[model samples]
Target: MALYKHSAYVKTSTSDEFDKVYSPGASTPHSGIYRCEGCANEIAANQGNPLPPQNHHQHTSAQGSIRWRMIVYAQ
Candidate 1:
């Protein structure tokens, strides 16, 4: 499993001129929690932290253990 912290995530307000929105990242995060983009729930995480998903899942990047950090928008 990989590792990351809360700081790995970044937030934004709006999307592009069309429908596609993008956030650029040159490097991957150290370690943190990852949530499902579908259900918006913790699907995987590393270490015995307070984060949910009690156990690790097959979900994650193959490049390395990075935060799949979920984005939450305020309505």
Candidate 2:
């Protein structure tokens, strides 16, 4: 999970983009901390840049495929 020292810098949003998921190597829709759905690994990505490639990490059979979900939005 993403951590912060000051709550004043963070605010909640109602944007639908927060609920969307992106595939590996896909163009990032927003800049923020993205968590891997399968492994819970987090990565900082920038908007318009491609996410980590397929071989970025390895997972077990139980972990499933590499899928990314935005957990924190860096406005």
Candidate 3:
């Protein structure tokens, strides 16, 4: 099998939602990073669930820009 770099963020509005997308002891390990559909940025993990709005930011990309945000979370 070929090794692929896994780099993606999980978007969720609530803790329950996050849990739904990711479960404990799941095969895919949680990167502790959550991406916001509003802005694309990397936020520090362990910031706690239901991350504060102040933690998000607008990330820029070559293909225009997106409002995706990210934060680290426990697995």
RMSD of each: 12.1, 0.9, 10.9
Model 2 root mean square deviation, Cα atoms: 0.9
Question: Candidate 1: which stretches are off by over 4 Å?
Answer: 1-29, 47-75
C-alpha local distance difference test of each model: 0.34, 0.91, 0.38
Question: Candidate 3 lDDT (Cα, whole model)?
Answer: 0.38
In model 1, what is the error at residue 16, expressed in angstroms? 16
| Per-residue lDDT over 1-75 for candidate 2, one digit per residue giving the tens place of the 0 to 100 score | 778999999998888887988899999888999999999999999999999987899999999888998989888
The lDDT leader among the candidates is 2
TM-score of candidate 2 against the unseen true structure: 0.93
TM-scores, in order shown?
Answer: 0.22, 0.93, 0.28
Q: What is the Å distance of residue 23 in model 2 from its true position? A: 0.7
Tens digits of per-residue lDDT, candidate 1, 7-37, equal 4454444643223222223122223334443
TM-score-wise, the better of 1 and 3 is: 3
lDDT of 1 at 5: 65
Error (Å) of candidate 2 at residue 40 is 0.7
- Please count the clashing residue pairs in each candidate, in the order shown: 5, 0, 14
